[model samples]
Target chain A: MSSQPRRRRLEVEQIGDVTVVNFVDRKILDEQNIQIIGDQLFSLVDNDGLRKLLLNFGNVEYLSSAALGKLITLNKKLQAVGGRLVLCNIDPQIYEVFEITRLDKFFNIQKEEQAALQAF
Target chain B: MPLTVADTMNYPRDVQPAVAANVTISSDPAEARRIQEEIERHLQARHVSEHDIFSIKLALEEALVNAIKHGNQMDRTKKVYISYQIFADRFDVQITDDGSGFDPNEVPDPTAFENLERPCGRGLMLMRHYMTEVVFNQRGNGVLMSKVFRRNDNGKK
Candidate 1:
């Protein structure tokens, strides 16, 4: 493996037992990047064995369906393990996307980070 | 003011909308991003409304992804042709891919409770909702979409 560390797709933090993940990129529209994000999120559970995950969308400006697909999969993974995945700080415009696809109803979306921390 | 983007779809050759920012590229995500940013820059330079820009950007992102990934299957050998016009009042773009097309209607309603968790198929729905017009060619490999800038009587966004 190359000694150089790979660029981080997510900035993860431990808020109590919840893993808070903030995106490093504003636009989550790239395919390969989205795939990497999914893998990293999966490892947070599969490798780290963490239960509750909180995704902070504070840095995300735009995200495509591919990104949504990853979130769905991550949500499923956490559910299978009896854990929870909560998303917070989504931009209103991006929230409209979830509303349009009705994913807003499917996923646990919180208006603020503090509220999201409590959900988990 | 006379013919809307929808009405001109079936008009004679002379009725076609004017073209701008027309280019073709391989099914590369980087190229797709570049073209998307180029159009976004044009919209910014034109003083398009923030709401309109957001809508256009979302629609364009979904459309380009569909063209490059689904239409061309991310094949570098395949090319995605893009033609667009950034009018003062509206933005229009036509993206065509060199691949067998699929029917947009065939896509299931992702909003349905059962399909909500599917993860895919929401791109087309968002595109239609955000764009003023979204029409695919008969072959279904090409998509023509438009976003009309919202203007009030005072013209203040």
Candidate 2:
């Protein structure tokens, strides 16, 4: 049986007590890529036992609805474990999406990496 | 069955002045990226603004994903039909899939306070938010969306 190819779409870095996850580049995160990203984040929480996470959207120009859904899922997952998820450096276009959906209220969105880390 | 403007046009010369294309893709999620790239090239050729391109791209991806994943249920045997057109001031996209259709009205509002944490209907919300118009067929197996460009101070379309 052929196995599914394992690909890492997010870069994880440790800063103090928080894990900063940076998107690779300014590309659209579609359904398939969102699934890959969700799995990686879930593993970081479940396997690596990370408590706080900061998602850096500096290079992410666009986000599909599926990608936003994945972020919600990650937020709930982390919250259930008493952990927190902070998002930072969101592109204005992408930020408008969060505003339209009212997700901006539900997430801890910051303007910069320093602010996001400080929030944690 | 794929829906096309040519299906209803009786005269060749009556066709609208727009760039349009149609394709049938398998139920693979990866195909969405390729479709997005191809559409981006077409939009770029027409001098669409980057902001408008990003909005159109988001709505396009959501519609395509809904058709392939929800409408077709990721059945490899089933195919998703996508058609798009770029006019001078607007971009139009249509996506259809072969599956048991459901009413789009039944989708709950994701922005509601009680449903804030839920992720089920955000795609449709985002599509409606970004697109100038979003219309679903009565059967709910197909969706048509359009994004109209706003003129800048220079009166560019």
Candidate 3:
């Protein structure tokens, strides 16, 4: 580890009817990040009005298959309540993962947040 | 005659010098996932960060898939060797198969124009991005990758 600070900042926050999950730098979402995201989802499970999830991976370089599995799991959880999950500002490499798995057909992916929000 | 890493096959073999550690698996695709898990666990035991473990796992999986799909041509009778090397700050892994060597450079560039829609090239690309270094040893029969864990060791998990 270098003395410099890490450029990546991963956070999951609830904003109005949507949960904004931002991932920065490198993909793989790591196990720590996955647990955090799971925690966030669990905390918001009771919010019936929480109908949308916006995953912003613009800063992410690539997502490991493990991270993709986590995302798929989260997507399924969100779908159970009539809520939807949408991807925003995804990098090409990460997008490639979705494409390879044919997950793009299953995921609502958008290039911008407003577009993702509009799908709701 | 001294047995280089290539001499032994069809059974589990330990790689020499333990620069890190190694494991061998049958060419069965079913064994791929298990061998990968074992490799990841071994690295975690050595205190490698979770992030680096993911990188190693991804790179190693890609190599193993190549070993099966391209190298051994999916022949269950053959074998594959997966080796690991752990240093003070980095880990190097290599996956070799029993089949004859091939040209690494001949591999199509995943980022190139026509190859955009192809599935195979992307694995090599992902391996390159996730690892600090990737090489094809002189034998041209395997892939070698090293990853330097970039974790901040502030005693923080």
Residues B53-106 of candidate 2 have per-residue lDDT tens digits of 888888888888888888899898898888887777777778888877779899
In angstroms, the error of model 3 at A83 is 22
TM-score of each: 0.90, 0.89, 0.54
Pairs of residues clashing in candidate 2: none
Question: Which structure is stronger by lDDT: 1 or 2?
Answer: 1
- Candidates in descending TM-score order: 1, 2, 3
Which CAPRI level is candidate 1?
medium
Instruction: Show model 1 residue runs off by greater than 4 Å.
Output: A1-5, B1-19, B152-157
Candidate 1: tens digits of C-alpha lDDT, residues A1-120: 225355778899998988899999998988888878888889899999999999999999998888999999899999999999999999988998999888898999999999999987
lDDT of 3 at B95: 82
Assess each prediction's global lDDT (C-alpha) against the native.
0.85, 0.82, 0.66
Best-fitting candidate, scored by DockQ:
1
Backbone clashes, each candidate: 0, 0, 0
Encode model 1's per-residue lDDT on B1-157: one tens digit a residue. Answer: 3233345554233344443766989999899989988888888887778888889988988998999889999899999988887665678778889989999888888888788788567999999999988998878998888877898523435
Model 3 residue A89 distance off true place after TM-score fit, in angstroms: 9.6
Tens digit of per-residue lDDT, candidate 3, span A1-120: 335343435566777778777764454534345455444554455453566778877677656544555566667677787778889888665575567555677678999877777766
The DockQ ranking, best first, is 1, 2, 3
Q: Give the Å shift of residue A118 in candidate 2.
A: 1.6
**List of clashing residue pairs for candidate 1:** none
